[model samples]
Structures are given as C-alpha cells and as structure tokens.
Target: MATIREELQAAVKKLFDDDKIDYFVGYAEDYGHTFPAILTKDSDPSRLTFDRKSYDNLANFLPELRGSRVGLICKQCEVRTLNVLAAEEQVERDKLVVVGVPCPAMLDPRKLTEGAADLDSLDESYWQEKCRRCLERNTPLADVFVGERVSTPTPAEGWPLLEEVEKMSAEERLAWWRRQMSLCIRCYACRLACPLCYCHQCFVEDNKPQWIDKSVAPENNLHYHIIRAVHLAGRCIECQECSRVCPVGIPVDVLNNVLSRDFAERFGYVSGETAETQPALTRYERDDKEDFIL
Candidate 1:
C-alpha cells in the first residue's frame, strides 16, 4: 500500500508539471492533525501532505473555486459527495482534476482526543461507527487514482444500529431520539459543514416557506434535523460530515445511514455513483413499494 504522503507527493508534482491544475486541494500538516489547505503555485508543491489522519471532506472546499481548475483529493465518501454536487450543478465537473485515494475509515475526533497524546497517534483511534460497516474504502471514480486497490466486506449484511433501533417500540424509539435531539443547540454547524447542503438559500433560511423555526428549543431542534435528513434522503452521499460537525456529539450518522440503507434495499440504489443517475426521491417506478406511503 502506498502511503498518503508518497501518493500526495507524486500527484502534486505531476499536477504542477503537467499544469493540469492551478491549485491542489489536500491536507497540510499542522501542529498535530492535518488541516485542509490549498497549494496554488508550482513552487509550493511541497505543501501537499496527506496522512492517515487526513479526514476532512475535500469536497467541502470546491465551491469557493467555482470557475477555476483545481485538483482535489477524494476518498470513497468524498467521491460520492462530489458526484452528487456535480450532478446538482453545485460543482463544475470539467474544471476539476480528480485525485482518488483509499480511505481506511475515519477516526472519531472525540475518541481520538479522549486519551491520545498527539494527533499523529490518533491514526489508530476508534473510527466512527458508520465506517465500521463501510461499503467502499477507496473511491470508485477518478481521472488519476492512487493507492493499492483494497476490498471491503459486503455492506449487504445490514447496519447494526439501525436494526437495533427498529427493535424498539414506537414510544421507546421516540424517547431515545428525543434525548439525542434535546442535546442539540440548533447551531446549524452540521448543515453548514456539509458539502451537499451547499444551497445558496437553505430551506431553513427561507422566510416564505419558513421550513424550520430558528429557535433552540427541543422541538425546533428536532424539526430542523428531521427535515434536513429528509431533504438529503437519497441525495446524501453519507460523507458523515453532518455527524462530524455536531457540537453535542449526536450520532447523526444513524439518520443518514438509515436513509442510505433504505435507498439501497428498497430501490437497489447508491448515491453519487454517476451524475447521470437520478436521485432516489427524484424518480420512481409506477409499481414501486408504497405499503407505508399510503
């Protein structure tokens, strides 16, 4: 397996030499953990450093460079996010230089900082729960991909947490979720941090529709999140950014993962596989399953 450092070095060097891109959007080493930074000049090619702990979604950086050519690092989930963004016209496909990498699940930031002495050491931190049952570790699409192609265990086995929740009574499930939602502050950090939620005017921010109230009450918080989850239903790429940015440390992956699981099971679908593919909610079959819808 080629290390992230090596792959990044070679990719940046070539991108510079070929003039394939004007900027490199990848991780740069910081005090301890890596941070997302851009390398614009060829003389600064040395700035591109990718390591095991490079976990932020690079797709989140694309919008700022809307009309320009740029190189981006894509792990499995980032690729899904990018494809969805591209399909929705949030990003320009022609202007992007695709760089794919193999992702070995991301470490939970909270768990990593719990007992870890240094950031580099967190490479071995306990990964987020969603990553435990990840279906893809490496990106499936790229113009110039790097890293040894690895295999992931079948994702069809089913999500454990979702099943456990399903085993609960309706009131029990509602109570469980109420506690989690009550912890939220309605900060909108999860929505802002997500690449998929890149709408210029978010539904929550709309005055006319007033899709959700801007209050910090539990009802408002739960309403906002539930609507956010519904809006992203088939469109969510499962990048887990929504969960990652949660201040209260709510396991928001449970929401996205549930929708993703249903999308796959009910529609035989996976988000962001292709820009040409219609999103799960945007299209439907005449004889589709609707036992619960009615």
Candidate 2:
C-alpha cells in the first residue's frame, strides 16, 4: 500500500536494475499534479509522483509506443482499453508491464475550475461523482500492483440521467441529441483522448466515400458520434475521456455508458475484468437467452 511515488520508483528502479527495460512510461509530478512522462536510465527519481489529478489513463501511451516495451499505470477503464488493444494485436504483450492502481475518482476540468483556484487544494468532496459509486478502485490485472486493494464501494443502483433520457419520447430524444450535436467542433479531441478509439484510421479520417461528412455542423456531428459510439459499444470502459476532452463540453460518456450498461445487463459481461477475456461480441453461447430465434 505504498504511495504512488514510492511504488513507481521501486517499479522503475527494478526494471532498470534488471536490465528489463530501456524506458519506463509513467506519470511524474507536473507543476501542480502528475502527467505522463517517460523515465530513462539517466532519469531522476525525484520526477516520479502520484496524486488526485493524475487522471490520464496511462494506456494511451501504449499504441503510440508500438514495438517498444512499456510499463504503465492502469485504472479499470485503462486496463479494459489495453485488453482491447492486445486483442487487436496493436499492443505487444510480452513487452508491456501493467502497474494497476486504485483510482479513487477523477475530477472534471470544469469541476476543477468551479471548485478550487488551484488543483492541489481542490476539495475531496468535489472529486468526480464516479468515485462515489466506484466498485473496483483497485485493479486485479497488473504485472505488479501498487496499493492495498480497497473494497469496492456499493454502487448507487440507478443512473438518473440515463433513466431520464429513457423517459423522453423518441421525438424528444432526437431533438435533444440534435441540439447537443449542434455544438460539436469535430476537432477529434474526444477521439484522441479516448483510450479505446485507437483505430489506425478513424472513421472520421476515412476519405474513400467517407462515411461521415467533416463539417462540424449538427448533421455531420451526430453522424460521427453515432458511428464512434457504435464502434465503442462493447469496448468502452467508461473512462469518460471523450466527454472530458470535448471543447464544447458534450456529455459524450452518456452515450458510451448507455451501451456499456446494456452490455452488462443483456449479456452478463463487463469490460476489463481481466486482460485476456474475450469481448462479448467476439463470442456467443447457444444457451444465450436471446439465441432462440423460434
């Protein structure tokens, strides 16, 4: 149950001492909080750090570091993404090291702005609401783990927003989505921030009879979002980065969560429970409740 800084240094030092790694990709204190930074042989241990604002899912470092060995910190969401990448052959398994950590909760930048003038002094109560319902603060799938696993807190039984949306008439739902889509800028910040949207050629970038128009207007925006969400339906780990990175502050995770909850309830599946478990869509059982077409 060491502090993130202590465990990080020990992990890095062990890798280097054993000549097992040439570089360690992890977070180090950055001015006010921790951000991703690569530590090499000559790096200083003083650079390593961990704290509340260390919100970046370290798995984002994997795809970009292709063919190189990596050691990364993972929360439940990040680990799910790494598992998806491994299944796709985008991440090299033998060369990677996973350091799972118990994530208490992550704060929204907007919440950060509303609460504290400085990140260090931000109130614990203002931390993301997701933390309140978190069931798996400590991850199970790590080559080496960092903290004493905290017991998963009992999750609140309802997603009020999702339920409210369900209560909307179809026309009302459509109208609401249209209004939200009107604000999209199509900068792809949401896509880039997502750990699971790592396709080599994202649909928005495809030009051969491109499936979606590039205009940031509502038509294109809605189309793009629908396509993106479908691609992530079963794969999303509820990292909420898409919503977090949006410049216009769209609640994009709402869409992803809708599907994730559906996947869990309909199929009895959850993402990132293990690094190697197959995606639900990738397999099917004959006894599955819906398999009978009669």
Give the alpha-carbon lDDT of every model: 0.78, 0.75
Per-candidate TM-score against the hidden true structure: 0.87, 0.88
Q: Per-residue lDDT tens digits of candidate 2, residues 79-166?
A: 7778777776778889987777777666666766533665545555666655565657776567888766667767667665678878
Cα miss at 267, model 2 (Å)? 0.8
lDDT of 1 by residue, 1-294 (tens): 666678777888898788888888888886776778888764565556766567788888888888888888888777778878877778888889888777766777777644466544444337766566566777767878777766775653676677888899999999999998889987888988888877778887898978777877778888888888888888887777787888888877788878888888777888887757666776889877887779
Off by over 4 Å in 1: 1-3, 113-125
**Superposition error at 7 for model 2 (Å):** 3.5
Model 1 error, position 127 (Å): 2.5
Among these predictions, the greatest lDDT belongs to 1
